[model samples]
Target: MSELLEQFSAPPLIELESDLEALRKHAQKVLMQHGFPQRKTEAWKYTPIAALERRDWSSDGPDESAARTESIELPFDAHRIPVHNGQIDTSQLNEIDGLHIEPLRAEQIDTSAYVDHDPSDAFAWLNLARLEQGICIRVTHTLERPLALQFSSSDQFKQAAHPRIRIELAEGVEATLFEQHRLHGSGLINLVMDLQLAAGSSLQHLMQRQNDESALIARTEAQLEQAAHYQAYVLDLGGALTRQDLKVHLNESRARTRIHGVAALKDKQLVDYHTAIQHRVGPSHSEEDFRILADNHSMGVFNGRIHMLPGADDSHSDMNTANLLLSEHARINTKPELEIHAEEVTASHGATVGQLEEAARFYLRSRGLNDAEALALLKFGFAAAAFDALESEPLRQWFTDRLKQAL
Candidate 1:
């Protein structure tokens, strides 16, 4: 325990803003009560932190070096916002009406508005305390084009980056947002994203994280007002250790939210997807669909939880998890939990983990295609459930092509 403290030096209170300082003190108090998350911690049970402790969390904030760097563009048409090591590069921000993108200072942000106080969420605690700067996004009117946030992180030695994002969507407005997390070197990335949707708003969010020899911990927090709708999809491919946590609160009546993802893993990679949805009021709905493809010695975990609060009458919630393992050593753990307090709510969950059907493989082989090709096609078919849910056609094709390439 003492060694862990030695590895990390907490920032002095004087260096933090008044608002941030208060949050930091609470975080510090929590850390003192519960040290870094251990295996016993429910959320951190599947993730290993020993590899993360070997490195140092130091972004040093942003500097002139960010101005000279360039972000690699994707094969999509959208307004791009490049973030280097968790800090947005203002020089690369494009101009767009009804959209405001800029740096977020500690003094200007309300920590409680985004992240909840979770004593067991070590990465979020660290993000709240060590966050130096981040990107803030606000959408007033309906957006004309999709907005993409390109996150790139690289470090020669073992380092860390904590990038924070706050998004606000106005009432009756609708928009699409994309995030691409591209890791270039060996390091740990702690990312936090908070989204708030007003009444009658709609938002579609897509994020893809691909990395090698790196560790990542990401948390997404969202709240939907009355009659609002939010749809989100995430694709996680290849990482030393990666865990993505999504928590959404349906605070008003008639709110709807859907979050799904695919973690196509390979080699010795590890990926864990955790999600929680709270139906706090009546007539709300939530659903989660997650699929995994584990090859080689990779491991994947999916934990979906649905909660119906006391007043959540006539709410509907469902969760489905499916995994396809291609190798004998490949493994996956899936759990779907439902807690209901209201009598009129309907909730259910299902999970399945298996390999390719030999009978189907034989049928395809008899049709002239080889075994490799047959399995590849079958794997693609298995992922179609989540693929078809994607709102972006180009992304759907890209993800399909990449999945084939991995095979």
Candidate 2:
């Protein structure tokens, strides 16, 4: 531990050496197999994970001892499920009818690869190796109120956490899910959430992460059944470093999906969001909207891919990405891709890289608003459209307040 700490000087990776060897081996193997994605790689041209390989960072299991006593907030009147340092805090969980929360056993889940697009995803393999505990949430038919799951960590020296979330929403049922990430100290958090939505079911997911000088790595994979509806909202605040990978599969016709993201970064923090939505069947629809604000020397990266397979026709999809470069040194890279193997589809993408309009700012200032107030108003207005789509009212308000504080 001493030698590792001396070499890297980061509190999180220092503690990962002795936690679990199996996870380390798997992570290394996946890294070697997949290698570092570079500019040549179409999916990783804008944001490369090569730096991770050169850094010699270690990813061990999470230590439950380092978690702070305080818990993060949830969105609705919910049954809170807390995972502290990769260990489920069942004591705080409230038993609710029509819902089941339990540890996920290896036999209960299928570890087989679901998608063949990325066979050697080092991050996915890392999650498979270090997953100490899996939280299973079954939303039965009668469940109505939102379910909130919180992932918190305070271990600055701990290596990595592969916390898995398996959510099963039964047929004809509806539920809202809130996933929040909170880091008390600086550390690396590698987490994966797998969701299964049954036929005629609906699921709303809101993912939030607010890190103070920490590195967070997260991946979410979701499968939607026929006629299922999925809505997702992602908000990423500044961190020492961060990366989020999201993959959604519209496996059946008439499945509707929408993804919205907001990112605010400053200082030297780096944040990246990568999303892939695949329409394997015909008659599915998808829309994506993202807004990013980068200040100081921060960097924001976004890569979105929409795929329509052969024989999949009548699919309608649209994507728009808008970025705000708040400083001369701040940077943002936006990539929107559409791969259409079918011709009878309406698909389009648009991306913009610019700052707030000076004229708009001046007009706001002339209307009795100070420079700071005017900027805040404009920022709020820019993000308000997407924020209003949040299914939970309290969650939307909480994020709004956070955005105000951020500005």
Candidate 3:
């Protein structure tokens, strides 16, 4: 508690100054009461950020209409929602059927009703405290095309900004989502995503974060109803300090979820990925697969756990993490765990960390490739397996291009 308390000199005083926002007020209260997560907190043990608790933490609020208009858009054509500097720009939003975008107004609804986030989670509390008209995305019906969420940031100060995103899928709705984080500058960005998938609904979300200068801490919470399916594919290639925490709740029977992510890091960058899936009812299942490529003096950490309650019989869960260290100084820490209280459940977990397979490199070299070319080919192939998990071919190509740039 003392270590986290030293990270901040004030308790979100900017949020306390605002009287118009109920969410901010509530979060301000939480911040004042709990402050931040300490080093003793097991969930945050691997991620101890020094900059986040700094006194200069501040945001410039929503971007102007001019800035949103002048900024460049993604190359591919899709239903795009651009959020720059923590402010959503709806000027060019695509009018997709069954999709609704609105401001998270203070007078509209209470934050507690829509969120399952932990109150003690420091960044989540900070995001709620400093949030300004964060976007609410809701899908009511089936959508043929994929939706793109473009989160961009431009801050070079010793400060930071918090962005809150909420996504709700109504019953029987099925949609594909694309989210990309394009960042510039050397500040901090805290983001929270709340996902609600109703009965018979399914969501396939693909995300990529490739910005080296900024420090990013992200959290995701997904709640799945009966027979609902949720799948996420994440690619992290950049950021000075990147940490992502993901939690999934299978509240009903036969719910299915899969979380697969790949991270390629270099230089002195650090990346931490954590996930927890709870099977609250019977016959639910989940699978998690992650791969990390570490080079230079970079570091990567992965921790995944699956929990099955007493009633969660007939469920199955599996997790596997594989890491390749490209440099002697690179480091990777991996932990995969499972807790099953049900007799009929099956669960397994494993992790592996080492250099590239010498046999594979030799095989590639024998096929008319030099040492450098063979290494490049092997690394590309290693990334391709996970990056190609997306159902969309164009999206995979777009991600491949970004990977090339980042790596």
Candidate 4:
């Protein structure tokens, strides 16, 4: 390595340096080679990674005490697995039928896993380096009910933790899962979830992030086989700065995917959601819907890409994004793309940035509500679209209330 490369490749923290030196060097080298994203990188134009690159992060292992105090609640009384500071709490784990949760093994590490994608993705490398322990969940044939995996961070300070998750759904299986993150710390939280859905399987993955005034970088990868159905919903409500990347591939025909997201920001927080979907086979469908509310100098970003392979004929996809700017200084950026190699496909995208509708506000005010009340009502209506799509009533109510309080 060159002098500059050698310098950047060295991690100052002794814990990380001692535990995973090779992985750390390899990860830092990738970041040094491809620095934080710039305008040239289409996928990262809206959410810059420069801030994350400058931070020096290290891990101190999992705190069993903090992990014990962390609690998470989902809409369903399903199997709960809590991961604190990147380590799963084995004591709190409960056994469930058709589901097996275990620690990730070294044999599972495959560097070629990201050969085709952006090698410099800092979080990806960071997770790879610090991923000491992770949960391996296998959903057997046709799950009896939904399952939930909760990752909670309670450490407060400059810290780093890598939590790796691998979910394998067998053929003909079906599951609705809530992958949640709760952080009370003020450091970097890097997570990577690798998922595989077998033929004729279906999965519903919902993500919620409720953290302190901390920064978070999260990435997820999913691979789907023939006739697989995958649906995702992401709700970002808390964090000083948060960014999530999703790479999904439909490797076989007749596969369908949908991504629905909602981001509510306040108090100078920044949130970004980027997604890429690739259809490698014929006749696949995908749809994306995103809603954002930014207030008090907060920022929100939405970037989505849909790719149709050369032989993927008769594919249909659409992306719709809407942003609500609650403060004058708040910013919202949306980028939607469609790359198609096939001649027969229906693809479209729509994006809009605006404030509350004066007409609606006026009508509500005239109907005897005060200005604040009217504005609150209008805002609630705007943010309710995504909540209505949720199958779990409690989760829907939880998000709705959080959104209202955020506004």
Query: Considering every candidate listed, which one attains the maximal lDDT?
Result: 1
Error (Å) of candidate 4 at residue 180 is: 1.7
Q: Each model's C-alpha lDDT?
A: 0.78, 0.73, 0.76, 0.75
Off by over 4 Å in 1: 10-16, 56-73, 102-119, 155-157
Residue 1 in candidate 1, Cα distance off native in Å: 5.1
Best model per TM-score = 1
TM-score, candidate number 3: 0.86
TM-score of each: 0.90, 0.85, 0.86, 0.87
State the RMSD for candidate 1.
3.1
lDDT tens digits, residue span 278-328, model 2: 887878999999888998999999988899998568888989998889899
Estimate, for each residue in 1-407, the C-alpha lDDT of model 4 and write its tens digit.
13323323334444433335566567666665664456566666656555654554454544556444756866667667776655566564456668777766655544555532453465577577555566678888666656667877665435666678889999989988888877766556677888889999999998888776556778888889999999998888857778898988888999889898888888878888888999888898898889988888888988888889898788888888888999999999887888999868999999888899889999998999999999888877887787677776877787787667765
Judged by TM-score relative to the true structure, which candidate is superior, 1 or 4?
Answer: 1
Residues 1-407 of candidate 1 have per-residue lDDT tens digits of 33453344433323655766677666656655666777777777888776676655444433445333546556567777777665666564556688887666665454454334444676777776666666678899898787888877664424566678888899999988888877656666788888889999998888787877767788888889999999988878868898888889899999999988888888999998889898999899998899999999999999998999999999998889999988999989899989999869888889999899999999999999998889888988887668687767887887677656765
Q: Which scores greater on lDDT, model 1 or model 4?
A: 1
Q: In candidate 2, which residue ranges exceed 4 Å CA deviation?
A: 1-67, 105-120, 155-157, 391-395
Please say which candidate is ahead in TM-score: 2 or 4.
4
lDDT value for candidate 3? Answer: 0.76
Question: Where does the lowest 10-residue lDDT sum fall in candidate 2?
Answer: 1-10
Q: Which parts of model 3 have CA positions greater than 4 angstroms off?
A: 1-22, 53-76, 105-120, 155-158, 397-407
